[model samples]
Target: MSNIKIFSGSSHQDLSQKVAEHLGLELGKVVTKKFSNKETCVEIGESVRGEDVYIIQSGCGEINDNLMELLIMISACKIASASRVTAVIPCFPYARQDKKDKKSASRAPISAKLVANMLSVSGADHIITMDLHASQIQGFFDIPVDNLYAEPAVLQWIKEHVPDWKASIIVSPDAGGTERVTSITDCLNVEFALIHKVRKKANEIDRMVLVGDVKDRVAILIDDMADTCGTICHAADKLISAGANKVYAILTHGIFSGPAISRINNACFEAIVVTNSIPQEKNVKQSTKIQVIDISMFLAEAIRRTHNGESVSYLFNHVPL
Candidate 1:
């Protein structure tokens, strides 16, 4: 660990700083600029020869720019003869296209695989990330990749923020999230419920059906990501209609792409908690019901452990009650 260096791209500079601080080191200097023609250029400011280098960049908005930055940084480090390069991505973008659900549609799992290949081909030694949209995305990488869970951080937030935990129940916004919500329920020693969503025809309203007793119980929705907040908002309305005492949600990444903020603001839930994998936009902060929890500390700790060859599995232990 004599020569461990961490560098951050423009996407999440704050998170990168937290990671550097947790490791008791200063972030390595680097300059990434875009040409007038819009091409990305990256330069390594310090020597990384024979050092273990980690680049922190989120594959969030401006995904292509951020992705290119990471790739170029890796290339720079490799050119400088770094002993190892590890890409630490908090949120993997374009991951929703992990498979081809429709005929004649090109699958973007290859896009994720291409990113992996870009890092590997550009001289990355390993990869560390968290809560991929799909688990099998790991299989696409030839190099060793470790995926961390956001549950630990989310669990802690719930314990501290949501009162009357013992009387709460976990709810999944859709069937796809049932297993994840179930895990949260088991960790908190609460019952689990799921909302069934059926997409009938194009431009038709999707019917939502509740699975378990949610009446008078605090309901917490759990999912990996929230793009538009449509699904969760609809589910929250159903839960409230079914007599739920209160409704809240915890999601890993808040892409907040389209009408996400407006929907979240007017949603039936009491509050929606999301991690700072991607920088929160201004409108998101204006909503009192939308709370942004900093996962910087969690990511920082993971970086520290990885640098010291310590076990990060402890992060997964004892989720909040």
Candidate 2:
């Protein structure tokens, strides 16, 4: 562990600090600033020669700027003769754009793949990220990639925080999340439900229909990420209308962009449980119903395992606590 160096980008300094502390190390010195022309400048204060380096950066807070900073940091480490450089991205940027837009006459770009290419070209030897919007994005990277899951943490949170966990039903807010819901339900041996959402346009939901029985049961909605949160809020309302006793929304990344805070404050969800994959201090303070679950320990353990050439699959099934 002595040769393991961890540095943080400006996206989420608190989370990066926590991860470093968990590994019994201090964050490596790195200075990042803007020039007169508004271009990004990064300077690594210490040597990283022959060391295993990890750069912690999330896909939030002036996303494009954060991403460029991460790329620069990785390149800096590589150029300094670091043995290996891994990007520990808690929330991957441009993940939702995993595929092209076929409906548009002018096809939309698959920005997710482009990000992967950028990281690799920037000299990133590996990538560690959580719950990518689409798993297939792994194929876009030529380097070794690890896509960690938040399921173990989410399950532990439900058991400890939510009452009647055994009686609760896992739910998917949209058809795409059915697989995630079923995996949780299988683990808890609980019933599962699905909500089919009709989308009118981006950030707008037309209608939501509950598929399975949620009557008189606590409904827990599981999703990988939430942007404006229209889907989760609408799904919660549909569950309540279908006679669900209570509703909770659990997510890996709570982007909470646009009108998300207002929606959660006015929605039917009893509580919105999310990981600190993306910083939530502002969002949590803005809404009483929003709660954050720390995942720094998991990321730290993953970093340790990678540095030691140990298996990280244990975290996929077991809680870090």
Highest lDDT model number: 2
Once superposed on the true structure, which residue ranges of model 2 sit more than 4 Å away at CA? none
lDDT per residue (tens digit) for residues 93-173 in model 2: 999988866676567888999999999999999999999999999999999999899999999999999889999999998
Q: Which residue pairs collide in model 1, if any?
A: none
Model 2: what TM-score? 0.98
RMSD of 2: 0.9
lDDT of 1 by residue, 1-321 (tens): 478899999999888887787677899999989999999999899999989899999988789899888989999999999998999899986677666655436642456666767878988888888889888889888987878888877778889999997899999887888777777788889999988888664223379899999999999999999887778888889999999999999989888877778888888778888888888756465788878877776777776677788887876653322
In model 2, the Cα lDDT at residue 183 comes to 90
Evaluated against the true structure, the overall lDDT of model 1 is: 0.83
| Clash tally for model 1 | 0
